[model samples]
Target: MKRKHPELYEILVKTYQQDISESFKVDFKALMGKLKERVGRNSPCPCASGKKFKKCCLRK
Candidate 1:
């Protein structure tokens, strides 16, 4: 799939990294700030499940 869709592959990979990395101890305010900067509430979810942001990651 990645070879067929490099752009999408990149998005999926980035999203995966974001999810896993969030589990580690990190700055609170800075992380939220970065999330807001990078992920809009209505944007496609970072989970690679084709769901909207508000319906996915936000629910967690």
Candidate 2:
């Protein structure tokens, strides 16, 4: 997974830990939106697919 989507892996680990609060749901959505905005179409899919996000799991 790391080899396929290093950026997403890094962010996921940095964002979520052992325990999260209920309020984190809001924060999580914001964080994910920010991430999607920050990532490029050429970036590897967060799902670990070796294809670009536009050609892989990204919703049309």
Root-mean-square deviation of candidate 1: 13.4
Model 2 misplaced stretches (Cα beyond 4 Å):
1-37
| TM-score of each candidate structure, all chains considered together | 0.37, 0.35
Model 1 stretches with alpha carbons more than 4 Å out: 1-37
lDDT of each: 0.70, 0.67
Candidate 1 displacement at residue 48 in angstroms: 0.4
Q: Model 2, range 2-26, lDDT digits (tens) per residue?
A: 8999999998888877466655534
- Deviation of model 1 at 24, angstroms: 19
Best by TM-score: 1
Give, for candidate 1, the lowest lDDT window spanning 10 residues. Answer: 25-34
lDDT of 1 by residue, 1-60 (tens): 989999999998888777565476455345445564577889886666698878866645
